[model samples]
Target: MSNPLPFLKNETPVNWFWVDVSTQNLRVMKAAHETVRYPISTALNGLGERRNSACTPRGWHQVRAKIGAGLPANAILRGRRWTGDCYDASRDPDENGHQDWILGRILWLSGMESGFNRGGYCDTFRRYIYIHG
Candidate 1:
């Protein structure tokens, strides 16, 4: 958190994003300090970097890539590809409609620290930890 002010600059020298699991908040920040915050839910399992932990890794991360930029809101996606369908609010989720989807905008994250959130079995990218949906 040292020098956290740099993350607020309207003209950022670096591109980065932050996920605060404690508060369930995602901060889309970095060079366009056009920062935006959104509510998020982390790992269905818990917190950790180990693969299959189903946990959200800790430490610094970057938006390695973006997906579904133009997809409609609540558009259902399967395995990162649009399922050619959108969520029907009238239908219940138990009806097998867009229960857990990585739809809308997806920002794949890669770890910035070695042996922690990155590298070996703790690699976030390998772990498929992302700021998605």
Candidate 2:
């Protein structure tokens, strides 16, 4: 694994979030030291960089924007905007739960590396990849 620092000096310590897909875990790191960990769910189709692949993209990324700043938890969002609704069991009355819902706060991510997860079809920003509660 390589350390990814964007615009920050190497000697300067900072906090970052590491999403370990294989372990289904997310960890908070301060200067390469783990501070906290949490469980996370990834895509059903696994990992990829193609559009509509229904997979998680790999590589370094930075948060491009934060959405739903003042919204309550489980706030339903569509097209990156709050739909003025919140999630409930009634939302999935059929219990199939096949719908992909973007809820709560969102951290829109943009890939940093070119020709991989950044430019063209691999662009994470255009793909609408996000980290949310």
Candidate 3:
């Protein structure tokens, strides 16, 4: 609820991504000022650090990897690999029936805090938690 910038005083003030699970919002902060904001959807199971919980982990995180660079919009990615299929809503609404495809780009996140979301079963990267659109 307060400015998170103070917590990052020791860190560089280049750019930071903040996700508020309560409001389902993601904000891009530059020098303590929000440059962009977007609506985000978190796991239905809510927040947790355990694996297979289908929950969003809380704690500091950094972008570990950037996926689907230069790829077309709506590109279907399965297992983090491009399937060469683009989603066309007009064709069939349930074309990808029973399957969830990671569309667009993926910002793979790695938790920075140890024993919270970084190591063991609480590992966010191992849990495959990503910010994708």
Best by TM-score: 3
lDDT of 1 by residue, 5-115 (tens): 343453445665667778888777776573788898887777888977878788767677787888997887777788888876574665755466666767788887777
lDDT of each residue in 2-88, candidate 3, tens digit only:
554444566765888889887889999998899999998888888899999999899889889999999897998877878898876
Give Cα distance to truth, residue 28, candidate 1, Å.
3.8
Clashes of 2: 0
lDDT of 2 by residue, 6-108 (tens): 5454454477888899899988899889999999998989999888888899987889999998898999988889999999866764368477678988999
| Model 1, residue 102: C-alpha shift (Å) | 2.4
lDDT of predicted model 2 = 0.85
TM-score of 3: 0.85
**TM-score on alpha carbons, each prediction:** 0.74, 0.82, 0.85
Count of steric clashes across candidates, in order: 1, 0, 0
Clashing pairs in 1: 12-31
Error of 2 at 70 (Å): 0.8
Please name the candidate that would achieve the greatest lDDT relative to the true structure.
2
Whole-model Cα lDDT of every candidate shown, in order: 0.74, 0.85, 0.84
* Candidates ranked by lDDT: 2, 3, 1
